[model samples]
Target: MSVVAVVLTALMFVLLGPVAAHAGAGPRDTGSQPVDSYANAIRQSVWVDTGLDGDRDGKTDRVAADIIRPSEPAAAGRQVPVIMDASPYYSCCGRGNESQVKTYDQSGNPVGFPLYYDNYFVPRGYAVVLVDLAGTDRSDGCVDVGGASDITSAKAVIDWLNGRATAYTTRTGSTTAQAGWSNGSVGMIGKSWDGTVANGVAATGVEGLKTIVDISGISSWYDYYFAQGAALYDGGPDELASEVESSGAQSHCSAEEQALRDGAPRNGDWTSAWQDRDYYANASKVKASVFVAQGMQDLNVRTKNFGQWWNALAANGVQRKIWLSQTGHVDPFDYRRSDWVDTLHQWFDHYLMGVDNGVQSQPMADIERTPDHWSTDPVWPAPGTAATQVGLKASGTNGLGSLSAGAPPASGTERYTDNPAQDEDDWAAQADQATASKVSFTTGTLASDLRLSGGGTVTLTATPTTTSAHLSAVLVDLGPATIRNYEDGAEGITTLNTRSCWGDSTSGDSACYLDTAADTENVQQTVFSRGWADLGHYDPSLHGVSLTPGKPYTITIQLASTDHVVPAGHRLALIVAGTDNGLIVAPSTKPTISVDLSRSSADLPLVGGLPALAHALRGGSGHHHPTATTPAATPSRGPAAALPTSQAARLR
Candidate 1:
């Protein structure tokens, strides 16, 4: 159901109380105002303009907002807890009569109301302020996403609130109970853009700001727009732009209005303004207790945002918490309304009101993955984690085996040609179809249960027939019952910044070294650019080619961190190919890939008996029991294999 419907249902319960058998008691207000009456329900919407002289001009930037409050006060004579919901990608679904409450952005693509904000907190006695930020909707000035001015706009909302409650009550009298009762305590909450603003303003250390709940927020724009060591995927951003820009225009707003909201990078305003607004500048300066929520599947913001701030909070010893869900972008899990609503209230109560809601005592982190139910670890990755590499020995078509310590052909190789044309839309062969690639290999059925709650790396030795070749790899959880493929950095521009439980960057050197220690907390990602060298004029000996047709060379591909569990019957398969759906631009114009199987293998560090140390540090959960005997080396052995005679034949 929509957030509106849910709010209404919750409102009914709050207003009528005991709807049925308690008919003798009749309907009561339950200490709240009547739902139908606008005054009683605090349903009247009004736009208040905050006078801020941003440009140092004689005139001020009139920052306007829609104030939605409860009809009656939760606590008389005390300011009710106030939450500021940053308006959506556009200005709509707010209380302003001048602006229609609709989903269309200024351009005309349909945008959802920040219903998660509008309805989620009102019933809980928190007055919500939804601002039509500068240059979007009814507000003035050009929009600058992730810029300093954008942050100023957010702080202006707070400044407006700190002074508006008294003015509102004096003008409207006690009937404006929400304004009258508000203790003036305030907090910031939102997802995505709003979340960004929350983090931004928190850095200012403004008074009345007690807590911030940032969900799906990006801490650094550079890390988001251009992942470290990777290119940007044109598809996702383009689609979002088309939707927002078109919808804003369809809403009948001025073309300039819509442009401000949807055309940031294109207009060059945001780029120019955000150059100095990086999160690393002041992320550690935020004094407010913070709670962050992130999605494991979030392709846009990813884990770096949380990783950055969370680590900062830890290093500074500030109170902080994080929760990861399987959803994408926004809350995708369809969390229960009560759980969602109460979480906000509890957070605010604990911080803003000092109500000891036990939010801190609850799980510091709740991470859930397939085959493994939700597990709460005080530390992320649960510490003392190990990565085991399962080697692959190729045979004909399907006969692939494990890696043995001693093999006769300790340096044999395999070659394949990747067709770049395969990359395409969602489910398109190029995007994620692992079975459609040239350099293909499989893994044997699992001998035991395997659960990888962290990141993994793939290293191999390759000799390109051309000057360079684009390589891609994927890890698949293949059980007898099901098979699911996980992607590596081989496809398109991928985010190289990954966070460990400690909120530190686990990214490696040069984007491929798989370094487990780095200040990911607000550091920019490093991207490697692919360049072409004429193959006819290129000298392999000069290019540091350790791998010959009969020799070996090593190439490493990095996969972002993840928390997942593989069941007992499942096989962890890695597939390598030349083209990665156009996401990975080859080092040269024409690409060919040949892998030396023997000398080429993933370097997965195994922490032998680290489980004991883990127990000592984190205490026993009874689930992390380690074996006494040394784990055997599972080698990749298959039917005898042969090397290709020539590069052309292998390419064919």
Candidate 2:
């Protein structure tokens, strides 16, 4: 037995006194199943020094780490790799489908670990470390939002596991604890904010981190809270910081929170505060292979988060894989439970355990074509995909226009007033009406199946009559299909009362969790992707600029990424408007904007090129049939209503 591991095992025995032995659950003598003695697992805690006095308490802050590992004394000489999930939500909100929180005994030892990570992986010879970010839980620090404080709080633990940082038995104790049982191989996994930390840490080029599974995670804080120069919500950084800040932060974190507001002004210009938290800028330094998953319709974290980061990583030649779903901001375990568990297990075994699993040989991307319908793409965005510009030609009547290939031959102008009362639904349902809140452009019917992959951009040439204006563009599929009702549930999945258990169980913690089902809706129109930009920030620098009342300036609004196939007979439409109701912050003034039709266009990323569109329009029925033909139930809203109040991570 290795000396260090032997001593650790002796200490565990001394502390635990005695334990009842049980075999890994299953029929005996049938097969070589993985063994995990759940009841005997070593559950403990350590305070990792972050080397930062974020609270200004004159002492370095410490992040609380709850650890669970196999207690097999027979394998005393063997060191284990780690699976870590670090998050600020550990103490405030919750994790997984059930919103499970951490529980501890009187002596501060962790009694219950949230999620199935510990219950499943620890029994298979992996150590699970759940970390409470420095600002929350039992840690001592102030929340810096997505700043250095958040990244370092997680990174310090990875450093400690690799013998590069220090750990203590207690928050204020001098007694040191060593990670002698670690082999220094780590794989980070999480959803939302937790997954985001994995991305940030991997970007640090951290040595021990071999892989990260980032699910519906963010790459940039500014991009999430704001787009280009437009604020996505009425609230900003200060409000988000307060949501995750520890109670102790009342004394010291106020300054940090205030600094966040000062650094990133509400005007939506990019600043150093956002730059400091951007992991995509440092993606070239990432050594860890990444597995990313996001909803094509995820409005909260937004598909742009994955699109931008994925492109940068691919450009840098970083190894990667992906999953593009048709749902919203929900975890895969809640939807694709069996497949997720199996694939994740193989991923960890291959990366962390050096197992010769063929995880790398599998398909590059798993795409949900529709609810419960999946297909694997050898390369995401589909091969041979390219950006095709579709011209917006004003019809000169009925508040409608034609979306044709290439630029318009003649110049024309269309105008609309900024209407906060109207949304995408109103624009779609009242296209021919003279409401003036939006301009609708549509393609002819009977086109061939047009498959789109990746993000698109909307360019408009117009002059606003007000000092400030906001532009919103949406790409809607005007066809009938039964899709996941993301607007009905918070994350598009309804958590049912029924339960199913995976892995081992114990008195304090169990692998059992509530089942979930996709909330489906049959609709004639669905908004696949939308984007916004502040018209005032029209300059290339994206800094605020004064708008001359009648001077025209060209601006581009970036649409979120998505993959969808618009079948024959179903027309595609591009709707442009100002002040997108419940979404973005409305314009300072209700601007009556003139859109130059000759210069305005929507660039779409499509597979099979121009020939495909021509073929689709040449006359043929759609390749598929619809589940229902009714109009949409809720058109203007997004898929976020069903999320339980307590489980809202709000930001990635």
Candidate 3:
């Protein structure tokens, strides 16, 4: 631990005392009244300081709290609102960089930050209480991620302020004993990790939590750390955990950090470990209203994760609202403060103060950047959208060609070699893995406006020249100047199988290749939603005129995610490669992939509604079953050959 952590931890114990008061369901009621209803109205004058009690050997301690007495108006029966801002880090040790003011104004602050708990809200009818979390800056106990320790800290502060029979509360309230009673509605607010803590507390069935505001905070580690068949480290090794902890001038305690440590990079293991801290598992027990704020450019907390949390809450019939803004990981308090403060006040007013502010009847999306400003829709992507699947059929003299309704099986096969030994160090860079072996297809002028707004998957009816081969399908949106990489919503992307694997060197088939790891029984698909930072905003009209007789440009769409608006003039391009980029490891260094077009095609489910249409236009759902191709008649069963150990792996 650093020097700051040491001091803050000590101070935390001196102030808050021993929070772990092992209470049983007995006669004594440790439950507290609403802080707003009791603490502020009664306390005549008060002093506050950091609360820290170390060596959880069951010892009580305290530090003075920042106290305030009622002004002249409080001499009457009028009750004032009291607010407490719990510190995620220890107070004296950690420097509060995130909650402080910025040097410059133009450089926006973080997203959905809650900063008015003490300075602004308290003096004006609100009394505030702020405590440092345990084992960080000024608090005690071994830190736990969504653990009992976090709930204990919250309960300790609430109980202490409301005069619940706590050892410290009695001693601290001696000076302010002449004050009247106030309500106990202390609305908790925080962003990112702090918001994550608030969410965890609510899920713990804590009483009087009132309302919660989550900004770019994912409900689960699975979605945040690993998303849609892509290993995060596959992009590059950045100390993600360190980065999160170092923010706000406070590093999480050693125990908390260990609780969130990532293990080996296998999907099965990663998903399993994530299941332990599954935030959604206990969401039904949460009794407070929630307000979620999402940043459009939040690379860590992907938009899909935010959507998942919002959708999950809605699915479980929980009361919640989501706000999407064009910001990054910074506290919204620093950047979009107006929107942040307004929304926070509205939410607190409705839930905490019982004010009918009409916050519930507002639009779901107060979308930034667009001219409309507020595209009010019941759900994401406003309704009435449709998806048009642009087929990638073999055309022209070579295997590469233009789009056709269907194409006959070609006699020859396409071969390529994938040497896993030759790994591209730059994970973010497009390696052009299929440069040696790929068949390209281009579409003619699109008949109507084509917009790709969803993640996609690919299913290739392929046979391996070697025992197994890696297959990658990509959709590219070609522009006039440079290729507009519009496949899935992700920008500046290339190649399919960016983070998955295929191929089997042991199975020898020189003419055809099979992806041993691919789910042949079920179409293999990689769904991409959110996390497309490299993709450029594709607008067909901006790229210049449409198909003018002889000049038609092609936009490449690989097996990736990109959002683009393809105009009538531009062409849609699809590329099939024997190499799957970095997504998956190939089975063979030298292998061939033969495509059976008669058996494979992109089956995009077209439906009305923007969200649905976006899903369809992106296509590549890998659920390709060629309705036009007839299935071969089954022959009589014969004696089975001895199963090879690798056969099960191949059948995967």
lDDT for model 1: 0.45
User: What's the TM-score of each model vs. the native?
Assistant: 0.58, 0.91, 0.53
Which 10 consecutive residues of model 3 have the lowest summed lDDT? 502-511
Candidate number with greatest lDDT: 2
Name the lDDT value of residue 604 in candidate 2. Answer: 90
- Model 3 spans with C-alpha error above 4 angstroms: 1-114, 155-182, 228-273, 369-374, 384-652
Ranking by lDDT: 2, 1, 3
Q: Which candidate is the best by TM-score?
A: 2
Q: Following a full C-alpha superposition, what root-mean-square deviation does model 1 have from the true structure?
A: 16.0
lDDT of 3 at 475: 55
* TM-score preference between candidates 1 and 2, better one: 2
1-652 in candidate 1: lDDT tens per residue? 9999999999987655522211113222112212211123343333343354333335444444556555544322335667776643443333211123434336532233334443444544557676655545645443445554467667766765566421222212333223444565778877666687788888777777778888877776544543332233332222332233224323432433343335334211233333444664575677788888775545445555566566566677668777765443434113222455456656775676555446777777777442123567675544556665545565533212233222245545566565654421111111112232343333334344444554555666767655334565554444332111112211111223542121111111010111121111110111111111112212332223222333334556555445555444443444566544434333334455666777566533222223322222232121111222222222211101111222111111
Count of steric clashes across candidates, in order:
40, 11, 108
Question: lDDT tens digits, residues 1-652, model 3?
Answer: 9999999999885443322111112333232122222223223222222243332335332322233323423454454444544444322222122223211123321111123344334333455444445443323344444344544556555555555524333333444332243455656666655666666666766666677777666576545444333332232111332222224213324434444454323331333445554566778777777777765544444555555555556667777776654343434443344566566655665666555556766765454332113333454433343434434554423345444333334343333334333222111111122233455455555544555533343444455444333344555544332221212222212223322111111111111111111111111111222221100111221121122222212222223222344454444555555433333333423455555554445532122433443333343322212232222322311101111122111011
**Candidate with better TM-score, 2 vs 3:** 2
